[model samples]
Target chain A: MNEREFLKQYDKTAFDQPIFSVDNVVFTVANGGLEVLLVQRAEHPFKGHWGLPGGFVDLQKDLTLDDTALRKIREKAGVEPDYIEQLETLGSSQRDPRDWSITTVFTALISKQRCVPTDENVSSANWFPVTTLSELQLAFDHLEIIERALKRLKNRATYSLVPCALLGETFTLAELQHVHELILGKKLEAKAFRRRVENSEQFEETGGMTSGRGRPAAYYRLRPGAMGFEFVRSV
Target chain B: MNEREFLKQYDKTAFDQPIFSVDNVVFTVANGGLEVLLVQRAEHPFKGHWGLPGGFVDLQKDLTLDDTALRKIREKAGVEPDYIEQLETLGSSQRDPRDWSITTVFTALISKQRCVPTDENVSSANWFPVTTLSELQLAFDHLEIIERALKRLKNRATYSLVPCALLGETFTLAELQHVHELILGKKLEAKAFRRRVENSEQFEETGGMTSGRGRPAAYYRLRPGAMGFEFVRSV
Candidate 1:
């Protein structure tokens, strides 16, 4: 049928409604492994269970999904993060109990920062290592969300120095390598890693030095506007 | 606030409702360039305008986002695609004039196959080259979605053998290179590209030969269940 024929049969309101929400997986490096920030639910649906910090998006106020993510982080964690990326969208009719909904998952990075729940629906906010996340049951499909975020982080770490977001403003080369090792789950050759970093041209010297014992390593920071490195793998 | 205290102040119904939808960017390689499948709208908002082939999710019956995508393609187009990946979600309050809405975008690749609109809301379904997408005024924010999908395809081609989806079931190494060149928008080195393809270990010989005038190239196909390649760049 032509455009006119199709127009006559089209119904404008033939669509179902669904609630849209945002969930955040805030990751930070602490102790010796990667940790994710989670909040305890206080509602009847798996009440008192652990889950990623999240909330329903206010369509009247939030302009974009990114805005909703930032707002939810602030409302739940009480701090701004350094890096945030849209990880994936988990949508299904049975994922949420109250209504059919879709949740756009986001992955954020912070440097061992504290997150305190500003909302009453959440009982507690704390960081848990990725290795131990499987032991505890998370509300909703949060466990799957965290797993996807970790996989994305690992893939991104190959071409980009994104794991540096887990460290302070300035860090030593050894500290940087450790972050990479923790995220990649493998020990990298120190010499090859240094060479790849220098070739990427994404970092600059901070004109400072580490004051700890042993040989003082130079403090280097991500360049002003570096997006990612050129190397795929170094070790 | 404690979890108990937070739960007291939380209102489950305190959220603004928005319309949720899905849009697909179906791409294929034909006539020496990349093409995208589009449909002419027959509704009032953008009657007679071109847009990505898509529709709203049915919360009443649809189970998952992936299912919705598959159904939309089967309903809008007549055939199923070989590859589909979540591109990105385009969300905003002002994007839709009739109502506030958010649409999750998906990118799909198929061999040069035909697609016909099964719904009347779409007058015509046709494929347009990516290079000439700007010449046509697409409805809503589809232009942005197509641009993003093209960029994603280029990046994904660097790491994965996704471009092979655009070719037929059996193809020579040279035909495969041509597909990569079209997607990457650049010519690649033959010797290095071959070495990289061999190292990826994602292809196997079919023991068939191309029946052409000149030297017959050996027909090769993607190894059964080959996900992605390891080569980043060889040119």
Candidate 2:
């Protein structure tokens, strides 16, 4: 048969297919630590347990896996993330109780200031400190997924300005350094951090200043249309 | 219902599911350029068209996406790769002719010396220079998938010992530099490159010497049990 005829005769339902879903690990810097947004599942398998915001891909609505991730983030988190990236895809016959399943996990960074506390679809939504993940029960392999994403985010913070997505539109150098420190789980020398940021040329003065600090520090914002820059050395 | 009862009643066949598959872009340094392995499809969908080695994830045989990728590589290329990494997952309604399909792409690096050329499962298999990709007609979105994999491999080579996977068990420093140059598409200064490699401490002297070419060069092998190390500065 020709190509067109072959497609017409193809029957996808002849074989067993894995249940495919997209999950988002939305992170923000809050309460002096990195926090991940999670929603209490409203349906079976893991209902009432906290899980990453996600669901089955709507074949009619999603053009790509990314579209599924983005749509889920909006529907469950009620906010637009400042940055998002595909973390990894995990699959197995054991991860889900329903059947063989596969999920593509996405990592998103959003400023906590932009998020609404909860969405109507989920039983409840909350931002929980990543440090406390061990004490809580989560659905599927979500805890493992979040830990992996956290490791990636930490490594990324060392060479790129990715953690800036956790902050507001404008901030002082001290605030920026704090976000980096939180993600890196360590302190950075103030002088060295300033030099690295200046060399990267990824930010611009916002002509604003912090009001409550000991010394009024100037505010800066990421340059218009400027993407994250990779630094030669860790800050 | 309880978890066990819920799983027993859940029917995966009730809902329409997207076809899930894994594709691998296996790369190696050969003929003084970067090359990717492609296999001619023996099945009807894109029969006889050159494509990245890939196929449907067998529910009975594959436990994870990586397993599917590795199985396809072995079946289509007849070689064990030195390194393999997941690139990204791509899904859409229009890309596949049979159905809405989702594919997780993987990038692998292998030494050309080990490959057996053609495998029994494919019509034909060969390594094609990445620079000539535009001239060849590829099946599905395989061309776009290969390009994306190529870009990721190049970026990885900049700050990690990833490109070494494209060499035999032992290779001279000069040979390693040549492989990096082919991937980066630019010449690196000899002195700077050597310094970077030495500082990374990722290789050990194999106590061998090259037999051909202008001066005999000392050979090196990746340190035993050593994973790829990220450099503080790009080489």
Candidate 3:
């Protein structure tokens, strides 16, 4: 059948409408472990409980899901994430209370920078250790979202240089390894880790030194074009 | 503000309602390259042009988006892909002709299998080599979706066992390497490839062999519970 003939029989208004929202699972390495940014909801529908920083995607101002996430972060926390990627999409019949909605989940990795007090919608914003996340009462399916992001983060740290977002612009090799260990929950042999990093072609020595109360170490930064490099690794 | 005060000021009805849809990129390796399953649209919007097999979410019957993708694939093609993963979510407000819709894209990898004749709603179903996909006029933003999925497949073949889905249930090491090369578009050193595969711990030797004209080669299958293994390789 020709496309024009098919179009003549098609009806566009017959499809059901569903709402779409964006949620961000922002992670940062702080306090010697992996931490997640959570906000205390001040409104109904699981009010007062903790939830990931997110809101309804504003199509009026946002161009993509990535823009929605960045806008939400900027509006609620007054800061931007270091790295953001689409994690997953959750669309169930009853996942939302307000409507039959589809939420596109995004994972935003950032350094240990606190969310500035910018909005009254959230009573409090804090970073909690992911290991003890079970103790807190979270709103909606946020706990599941965080778990999925955590799994992705752990797996991605081995291949992509995304985890570098959890470190400052310039960091020592030890600091980089520490961020990796916190996410993967395992210590890496220093020699092997260094060798892998050197072979990855993702990092470049910055010719700077770490400022700390110890023997100063050389610093390095991720090469500009290597952010999307997929280095194979046996994580 | 306390939680109660915040709830009093919050308004849920102010959020804009957006429609949701699911799109599937069913991929297979055929004709010596990667191929994507495309169905001719028998309805309007892009009547006659080819598009990814998908439909509006059937929240009335399906429980989740994953279920929606599976149900659509079953209804349209009469076959289930071997490995399916959430790829990305596209929500650009005016992406749809009927309404503001957000479509979650899924990538379903399968071995070279033919799509059975099924739904009459689709004018036709065919597989096209991804390399020449640009020549075909695709409906909606399907061309962009396929490109995203193709990039993901190429990168994923280096780390995860997903590329194995493009091969038969059991395959020889040489065949497995061929699948990887086809997807990655590069040749791998045989010795290095074997060493990396053995180190992955994701595959095990099966007590069977492939009967070919040259010589019988031992068969290997993905180790139990290793389909989700994240093997590291420097792709």
DockQ for every model comes to 0.39, 0.71, 0.40
Superposed model 1: Cα runs more than 4 Å off: A1-14, A113-123, A227-235, B1-14, B114-123, B232-235
Residue-level lDDT of model 2, residues A21-97, one tens digit each, is: 88999999888899998888877889889999988788899888788899998887787789999998998878988
TM-score-wise, the better of 2 and 3 is 2
For residues A101-155, write the lDDT of model 3, one tens digit per residue.
6788889987775445566644477888998999999998899999989999978
Q: What is the C-alpha interface RMSD of model 1?
A: 6.1
Q: Give the TM-score, chain B only, in order for the candidates.
A: 0.88, 0.95, 0.88
Provide the DockQ value for model 2. Answer: 0.71
- Local accuracy of candidate 1 as per-residue lDDT tens digits, A3-45: 4566577543455466678899999898888998888876656
Given candidate 2, what's the lDDT at residue B5?
84
- Each candidate's fnat, listed in order, reads 0.53, 0.71, 0.51
Cα misplacement distance, residue B141 of candidate 3 (Å): 2.0
State every prediction's TM-score relative to the real structure.
0.89, 0.95, 0.82
**Worst window of 10 by summed lDDT in candidate 1 chain A:** A114-123
CA error at residue A198 for candidate 1, angstroms: 2.0
